[model samples]
Target: MWNTRFRLIFISSSTYSALGLLPMRPCSSSDPKPGCCPPSPALKTGAWHSHCARSASPAELCRFRSLGPGTSGDTGSAAIESVQGAKNVDIIVLLPKGHCTKIQELQMTTVLRENVHVFGVEGNSDELDEPIKTVFADVAFVKKHNLMSLNSINWSRVLVQIAHHFFAYFRCAPSLDMHPLPPVEVVVPTGAAGNLAAGCIAQKMGLPIHLVVAVNSNDIIHRTVQWGDFSLSKAVKPTLASAMDIQVPYNMERIFWLLSGSDSQVIRALMEQFERTKSVSLPKELHSKLSEAVTSQSVSDEAITQTMGRCWQENQYLLCPHSAVAVSCHYQQVDRQQPSPPRCCLAPASAAKFPEAVRAARLTLDTPAEILALEHKEARCTPMRKGDDWTRMLRDTIEDLSQQWQRRFLNLPA
Candidate 1:
């Protein structure tokens, strides 16, 4: 039964991107090096600034912005680094931003270390935890801003837009090599942000992409998409996937807006009802639109553990609880579809981040001895409320980084 149930298939990008969906763009760069500028002096403390990469041809630079710093990590402000040995190509990563586990952080770090230049961006909930914020700040030059309204827009969705365009522009340039895989077609993200990101990417690329949203116990988004009842759960449950324990998915509004034929009145009515009664139901037509573009599935806490354990025992692969949820959902979808199309799952965390979950799954993470050797802060955090000035600070910081990158570009030896 286990063997029959598990259908592991890699979806080819060609089915989605190359065959008249969204064409893959070539990779080219004006700068041979794949790093942003080190740091700018004109940059004021706690301000946002733009950082960009230029094309080898006389094309405009590909740019994005980042915000000010938290208390810890690089300098007194957020910092981005272009690690050496990074790859030069286009990629789509569904980063949970604030919710990533150490394993995902390491993977991202490894990506940059491979010499692939990364332009960072900020997310709202990304301000939730220290580990995510610290790693993102230290690793990549970022662009950050508040959404149209915090209540409606999802941060991960916005970052995906930034990332998609960042690579799209990069590959479109005349001077670079081509991407091996075509543009991605189906993106399986663990939560609302990932789903929202997929939607944004599809909109930009002018392709009809299938968005598969994976959920833990907090199944509001799942139910909304599946049953047409977009109602809020009364309480939030704590699961192994702690970050995904949100009962209210802010980004669902965007999906509703897109699926409802971009009707502002419909969006306003839904939002008002949701705010008042904590529930909203989609009309059949709108539900049809959502059903056609997205698939939603929920995995139980027990199933998450089993998936994690099974992967470790059968494949020697370790997955954090959140990733386990995504994989489990993927398998379920595959079971039904049997030979499903090319799909990408966003595994934004590592097993090490949730050691207890790993142990519960009967697997052990081979954590590096040096990491275990380091002193760790007491596992405590106070809820930090975002300030109004965050956007301004982020903008100034991005500008500073942009200036520094420009200086580096000018000084490079021809």
Candidate 2:
């Protein structure tokens, strides 16, 4: 049986941070007080911030899974660390059992925190989102619990990510003195297409950027861009870049919405049709706009390993598998002698988090000692087996925690 604790907090809308509805506070023992952290420069401009948090109840609900090697670890660590020692804040994370690499799993499960609840489900990352969506669909339940997602599905995630494009452009741009800013090409290793959507939004907002969508064996995004085939593959092919091994790129809908001039009706119809049939051909106009806005390429497992090895040999920089996916596209363009703008390949994770990928690349593993220590730590997470009603399990867990919290609030015994 899993031992659970409900040390939780209710964050009001005005206090939500750019990362998600979850409020960000400075993490330090000395400053244990809870308050709104300073806003980023992007938020300071009053452009990307959304009021989605304001419409929700006070309790924060974050859904997390191992998207890739470093991504899940980073996300899980940040989520746990942010609410450390905070009262009335509980985070329930659902990760795909046996899908994530050992290091990735341990990075999340090893944290023996009372407020953090981690569950291992027998499914892929996309499948984990199903129960979360179902739970969030109950408006009354959501309000009663004050729930808000912290994943890429949240508008706040995309809004915060919009800053990445700006930062990359400013760093890569040659001069700001020109009549129009010089265009920079951003190669994003995409799975859920959140960052790619952010780049598109940035482009729409007059940023001079050419976005490149890069992917591994699971190449739905590549197919969507290269062809008008907005369809799922028969199955998701697991790759060294485990995060990009998603057949469904949900954020592509946002791109379509943006490119189609925000025609909500068309977007809604198309998405609904897709939800029903698991396939849809992009409209000619939308396809044309998508092609113009973004170019994409799909890398293979071989390519990922090759890029990782080549990067280590040439620059002594070991890239995580997901990063190598984007770098592979950069290498292809260079190899083909194609004329291109100043390029920045977004490397979202460290190689240290992907020892399996590093070993597969035939390179020496150079993981930090701290990361190595995770293997020895005691870890715990409830397993959601094949026959289990995951949604019911999730709801039961949330309900139990809420009841426990309520009881404690009223000075009742546990």
Candidate 3:
């Protein structure tokens, strides 16, 4: 499932001002042409690639090595580019359901390339390896079709990608005074096991991290973390905070890698925590430090709605569903602590994405402009149950659309 704890930051902006908050890394300024800020060369893995409108059929166009990532970059981080001609490469996405309700499943099935293969992982509902098995079956189906998954299991990517940000965030902090920041604990609300996977990596790197979680009354984050397992609890639905709706821990392999260590090293260090005690499945006695664990404290949906209203009224900031929860936790944590560590709450999506929720919160509409545009009442999605499969829906739409693909590669070469 997801970790309720979050990465702490030291910034002076209000919740509405997340954009203005200092960035973790600045885009290299003044590049001659675009192709410069590339991902690691190793990522290419030596496959075909292009932006040309070659291969008229979706099936014929999926052999390329690189994928057209619909990377909705934060404001100035990376301009959205359209991958005009990149077609169906196999994809394994971990997300909640109902995320792509705005678009049809067939469209996603057909949009990329004929080889455009897609599999959705039910991370939001926290379904465990069942979703992974479903994805594997899809991969098997696609294998006969000449398409294969980039990452059928999410934990591998979690191990690698998560390492960068946790390290990068502390490195970028001008305030941390750079004390090797190991044992530098990070707590995120686990809606999916992704954040916890990241924390496990940071911990392995010798950083003392307290992986905290927050969930509504029926959430499974506590069950997963406490039992070291995943639960398919149908009772839990989306609360006011939509993103923290996951019930399965997708990246469990990574967690085991940390826990199965010879030392209870992780648990030994973290056992001092109150309601959430730590236990290192690792059995060795090598020098270790425990980053404590913090359990969740729920906020009323009324509180969240009101919090959104108050933030806009008091600070002129727009808080989407997920960010609002972070703000709530932040304010509470600040009041509880004598002095809070500089905290940074990562908003994975834009507030504009959820209009009904925003309207429900009674915030005035802002002009819609691409992702920047938030006023498309017609295109707005309504989740079936709260947090049902929203992320999957989102990943499906993001992967299947011709327009979204185009936006990802807008400035890049053919």
Task: Point to the candidate with the largest lDDT.
Answer: 2
Candidate 3 residue-pair clash tally: 81
lDDT of 2 by residue, 1-414 (tens): 111110111111111222211122322333222222221232312122223322324443232111111133344444544553446666677877777788777867887777668888888877887888788788898877756666677777788678777877776666789888877788888788988999999999999988888888888888989889989888878788886777777788999999999999999999999999999999999999999999999899999999888867755666788878887886786565555666666665557777889999999886789888998999988898888898899888888877777786777988
> lDDT of all predictions, in order shown?
0.45, 0.69, 0.40
Candidate 3 wrongly placed segments (more than 4 Å):
1-84, 87-132, 135-152, 171-185, 216-218, 223-234, 262-300, 371-414
Between candidates 1 and 3, name the one with more favorable TM-score.
3
Tens-digit lDDT string for candidate 1 (1-414):
111112121111100111011222221222111111111122322122112111223332232222222211111111222112212212212223344344333333333322222223243232332332343454333333210111113253254343432333232233334343233333344444534544554654554334567788878878877889988776766677765766656567766776676799989998889879988888889888887777778889899899887656645667667767777875565445444333444444335557668877877778856445433422212122344343444344444445554555567532
In model 1, which runs have C-alpha deviations exceeding 4 angstroms?
1-187, 194-197, 200-204, 334-337, 377-414
Per-residue CA lDDT of model 3 for 111-226, tens digit only, reads 34332333443333334234334534565433433322223143333544365446535643334555665232233544545555666566666654445554444445455444
What are the RMSDs of all candidates, in order? 13.8, 12.1, 12.4
**TM-score: model 2 vs. ground truth:** 0.83
- TM agreement with the true structure for every prediction: 0.54, 0.83, 0.55
Which of candidates 2 and 3 reaches a greater TM-score? 2
- Shift of residue 220 alpha carbon in model 2, Å: 0.7
- Displacement of the residue 55 alpha carbon in candidate 1, Å: 17
